[model samples]
Target: MRLQVKKWNLSNHSDYEKQCGQYCYKIVKTLLNFLKFLKNENDNFNSIIEGKDRQIAELQAKLTSLYSNEHKPNEFDSLRKLITESNTAVINELRSQFLDFHNNGEIKPPYDSLKRCQNESTEYNTKVNESKGGETYIESPYPNSCVPFGNSSKQYKINVAGAGSFHVLCDAHTAGPGWITILRRADGKVDFDRDWNAYRNGFGSLNGDFFIGLEKLHYITKSQPYELYVHLKQLNGQTIHARYGEFAISNEKEKYNLIKLDLYSGTAGDYLKTSKHTGFSTKNKVNIQYAKKFNGGWWFNDYTKSNLNGKYVADNNLVGMFWGDLKILNLVKMLIRPKV
Candidate 1:
């Protein structure tokens, strides 16, 4: 009776168990395939990342090589060599011309012009042949004066108008302790009419009093010749003898004039001034004063007076004048023995 009951439901139960086993096997296979695909994708991503890193490194190396200062390639080197050679050639040519002038007694009127042209040409060539990003150094002239001393060689230019009066007073070191007075001549005598007020208060005195009529035009050609007149005056009064410095005509031209004055001594509050009756008018003016107080024969400031009878002295350091568009094209240093 039992065997007959169990056999009656056995077919359905077996079929259900077989269907569940097949479904479990399919799920396991799908999981394994998905894991394999994931592993392959990870490998591909890692390869792409490494490739990008290598590309970045290469770009960095290329940039470094392009911008390095010391490793400028063949093009820059060639350009540098060319410029060096050109400069050497130019210097040699100049030396030859100088030697030729020395050997021959030919006073050439065009020598200055030629020299200016040569200098300009050489500068142009140097600029053209120099390498890109290369640097150039040019020495400057002495500032405030044609000649420079000490540690500075700074240069500056001063331009004046045509047919106009211009004055420059520099430190005594530049002109010494001397004073210079300039006046122009018209038909005769000092013509103090047109632009005559230009010279008023040209020089100030140590006592704060200005010299009114100190300048006069001596002659026509001589007046316009750019003369330098130096005078000496007593400090306390007109009794004590002071030194009168030297003078020089730096340049004399029909269209322009230039004068240089050198003086000695160091006095305070003493200055140079022009007069209203002076024949010339002020076009451009540069005034530099040197004031010093004497203590035990040494120059000191009023605040630093440690000894009695301290006298204030004013010395002319430098004085110069230029007319008709002052152009300092070139400056040369010349060592000369002091005039006795």
Candidate 2:
């Protein structure tokens, strides 16, 4: 038996072209208007361009299939070649823009965010990788290095849009005379006297002298022992809580003591915890309270007992983290924000 293939027909589509074109025309017009609207943005430039690239690629794909197959009109041959070439060119252009601006080819958006998030003051050395441009590869400047957390506490607002794993590095050996705080404000504006809630962490020797932790700012002082001072902006804020927090750590340590802060989904909710390789380990669950015995002590991982990794120390002079989930909105900037 002989089998024959049937040639497809665009004429059959004549019935739908007018209707489809009318609908698509409206969508295309809307998209163009939206693109223009996005042009006003200087902050999310990379994201905007990325979105444009995706739309271009998708539209090209659809058109290429139409022209190459069933709908191969007499006018389509040159157009098909142009669309295929445009796909390559457009993609190359997008990639080229990234390399020019970011010096990295594998970049994703929130464009300028692809660059280092540094304070205008060279003094605050939040050393970001000039090429990669993010908080992921931050480096503290010197021994006992300490800087104000999340920009200035009084002037700028550090906002977060999502929640994820993060870290804190410092002289855990010396602990430090430093602290970092993540606050939840009314309008991303932190009012020290009135802001609702926050998460704080630190390391150092002077901790007893100037540590303002989970406690509310009003109730906290450099020397206060009030742990419940957390000013709650909202409970669910953790779920979408834009990643914003205060941080302080001593650069005085001899080793980098990589403190991995893990916040992810768990049995109860989004839990924030930490881990270290040696010395003392961060408690599996955050210790929400400060008592006479475990006051400043980090939560000891129950499984590992007191030692970090496997090494044990008798010094009861450390503290750890907690666990839970929450939601936040419209986080503009923070060292530990959403998943890029």
Candidate 3:
């Protein structure tokens, strides 16, 4: 009986050993898998860190190059400086060079030369050298008015003929697109009651209220025949527009005279037609009797017809942005497009 009992105990002990071995093998396999996962995660983390380090090194190199004494300014930088300086002699000299290039057939034309230069300048200023994946290129400046953008309502940089490069808000969705907003008054953040210089050179933000400037207006209008569209919004959200088939203004020497306002048609009355042949007037440069009294800039007539640049008020006062007897406007926009 004692021998049989011993045999039974020995068999049970052997089975217990086999079970322990199997359990230990499973624990080892699980540990190996866990270690492999940790290794993979570490490799991935290292790769990401290396990529970030490369980006950082590239950025540091660019920064060093930008601030280096050996860095040279490109043609675009030179032109931007000249335009910003506003030196008449330098500008004339540049124009003369462009004309010479035109005459020599090296460039297409004077306008094209300026436009090319401005486009290159814009590209140069916008280009950022970085990693292949990080590199980005902005679209070149529009060669002419709003025509280049083509039915896309957004602010685009336009190189005006003989007027240099600047941004303009193109009204594409409203009234069949391709209209350049020269003046807009909304929120009254900009002070339109400015001086002759301010009015001539322009002021305010394109995103808010802004005037595209008289000199720019003269160049743009004189370049091609344009139809003017004056948009007005009432306090009640009603809107009206006055479109003129012919609209233009003279140069600064002529005091930016409103030369033409023919073929007017719109919901608004033809009050501006009376101001035809009149020059523009600000508070300081009052060409008309009511120029100072109106306290804003416009081609004012002998009487108070319309003052879109007048004080922004919430009432139906004559002093606000009113067209003839129209009530004080909530918003006003003056845009133009090349005659179709």
RMSD each, Å: 28.4, 25.0, 21.9
Give the alpha carbon lDDT tens digit for every residue of 158-199 in model 1: 112111132322223323432222321111222222122333
Residue ranges of candidate 2 with Cα displaced over 4 Å: 1-199, 205-291, 300-304, 307-340
lDDT of 2 by residue, 60-106 (tens): 56554543454312123334344445444545554455555445423
lDDT of 3 by residue, 111-182 (tens): 543454454434333443221124442323555688878889899888765576888889986577789999
Best by lDDT: 3
Q: Against the true structure, candidate 2 has what lDDT?
A: 0.29
Global local distance difference test of model 1 = 0.30
Any residue pairs clashing in model 3, and if so which? 172-177
The TM-score that candidate 2 achieves is 0.17
Off by over 4 Å in 1: 1-230, 233-340
For each candidate, give its TM-score against the true structure. Answer: 0.17, 0.17, 0.58
